[model samples]
Target: MSSLPINPPPRLLMGPGPINADPRVLRAMSAQLIGQYDPAMTDYMTETQALYRQVWATTNEATLLVDGTSRAGIEAAIVSLVKPGDRVLVPVFGRFGHLLVEIAERAGADVHTIETEWGQVFPVSVIANAIARVKPRLLAVVYGDTATTMNQPLDELGEICARHGALFYTDATASLGGNDFAMDAWGLDAATAGLQKCLSGPSGSAPISLSERAVAVIRGRTKVEAGIALETDEASPDVIRSNYFDLGQILDYWGPRRLNHHTEATSMLYGARECARIILAEGRQAVIDRHALAGLAMLAGVQGLGLQVFGDVTHKMNNVVAVEIPAGIDGDRARAALLADFGVEIGTSFGPLAGRVWRIGTMGYNARKDAVLTTLAALENVLRRGGVRAGTSGAGVDAALEVYEG
Candidate 1:
């Protein structure tokens, strides 16, 4: 076997997530490793917590990273906060909502779900009604679901949950950084996100924030593993089921206690830190406005090609759009051509929307005028070649330019 250093080919990822990481983040991740508790490493960790607080728009002292993909954060929050037989309410708008339900069930919660059509979001009144009926201990929702390119509004849900004496949690994996999210202002008790989408980095790290109330729930269940237990350290009988996902122990690692939990993933930490740094540097609102403009341009360009946009436009996320594939074109074949011929990748839908719509994203590093225009041009060519009439030549690009020029 030949021993060769690794190299990867380049392609512009214009899909829902795990998009191109920001170059600055890559460079930071390339920095040499450091011991987990080295003063420098701890300082980096502290700074990372501070940076993610801004990213999450919170003052939570419990803000930190989970050493896995976005789903790790989701599971950690659920398994820790939700005890067996507790009532949990999930408002299912898309695929990720189903994920919350599944995780909560595995955590032994008595999970109840209220579902909307794939392309629709729940009215606040509908959710409030469910909370009234279910009387759940926790209400879990997704801020954005790439499956339908819809964003469920959470501005009022948190206050509703508080009034009902239930905790509020949301997975912001697809909407953070590139969209408007206010963890404190919106009264969210806990929230989690990934670097792959709006944060503009790879997917191995999950940034999460927990309000003091949520932290108390997890702290009540704290159980230091048997191997690491001290004589004075008391372990709770209501321990979190998953060893690696115990957030109480995780907080001790990130907190002033400096307790060891696990060997930190240094490279992913560096990348997550850099992602937040870049977004805060650009101004969070400005970065969101950039995604909004790019998303609008993409929507306009696809409409100019005579394609129908999916979902409720008003509730759509600012970073991605779902466009209905034309009647006679093979959606997969057209996607293949865009990848093979143009070296640009878009995303497909799941479940109910599988073959009916294509999800195109303008997020993170790829959310720019050039990227939007290039995808539009490439998509127009592919559609025409696939024997689907996609407006006059250059119409798609021209329409997108109008959005940028405006």
Candidate 2:
């Protein structure tokens, strides 16, 4: 079989995730690699943790990366924290909500998920009631779900968890850098995120932070090694359950003593660090404001073009907009034309809502007026080509221009 070379097309990623990475992050990743235990490399690790502290809005000394995707960090936090037969309550308002329940269950927790309609979020009353009734040991939820472009209202829920004495955990993979997230202020015990989304970096690293309370719980379960505990003899446990993912020893390894865990993904660490650096340098509130304004532009443009929106507008994710696929417009065909003809890549929905919604993401470096306007224009053209008598011509671009100018 004739195989093709690795060269690929340059298409704007206006999709749900794996959005366009910033050029600075890419450059950082391209720099020289080093040994995991090297002094210079460990310096980067420390700096990376510090940078993530700013991103996550936490002073957690244990803030660090797990060497995998977003799900890995979620699993590490859930499995490591919850003991067998622990009662965990999960809120299922979107696809990621289901993920929280699944992860907790697999870790031997007795998981009970309270589900609402896919496009909606759990009311604070419902969450409080669930907690009062179930009295779960932990509460796992998602901040934003890319599947439906919805952001759960977490402030009140976090307060409820605290009042009920249940540790709160969130997967902020799809919205961490793209929107507002206050780990400490919002009373989160543990939170997980990936570099692939708004962080505008590669997918190999998961940034995670644990509260002091969370650390106490995990530390309470630790079994001291008999050999290692003795001063005269030294031996580590059998690679910590799963060597690559174990975060217990990882904390010590990354801590002041410079112990050894898995060989951290050096390139990805560079990218993740640079990602947080950019966000911190830009300022967290400013970043969130930028995403808000630019996202609103995209939303208005899509609406101006006569495309319907999916989900409640009030609770939608700041960086991703979900628009309904109109009649007579072949969703797949329009997506193809947008990519091949216009060099843009918007997203499609999944599961029960498949073939109905087109997810347009304004994330990372791409969450700007220019990118938003360009995508709106390209999508409008594709819609016109696909037998839709819509798109206010250049109106979408005009509105975006106003946002950019202001």
**Best prediction by lDDT:** 1
Candidate 2 per-residue lDDT, tens place, 1-406, comes to: 9989999779789999888889999999999999988889999999999989989999999899888899899988887778778899998887888888887877778998888887888888988999999999999989999999999988877788888899999999999988888998999999999988888887888999999898887666544322133232223222223434556666767788766666788899999999999998998888888889888899888887888999999999989999889998889989988999989999898887799899999988898877998898998788888888665688777766766676
Q: What TM-score does each of the candidates earn?
A: 0.97, 0.93
Candidate 1 local lDDT, 231-322, one digit each (tens): 44344436688879999889988899788889899999999999999999999999999999999999999999999999999999999999
How well does candidate 2 match the true structure in TM-score terms? Answer: 0.93
Backbone steric clashes in candidate 1, count: 0
Global Cα RMSD, each model: 1.7, 3.3
Model 1: per-residue Cα lDDT at residue 145: 97
Which regions in candidate 1 have their CA more than 4 angstroms from the true location?
Answer: 225-237
lDDT of 2: 0.85
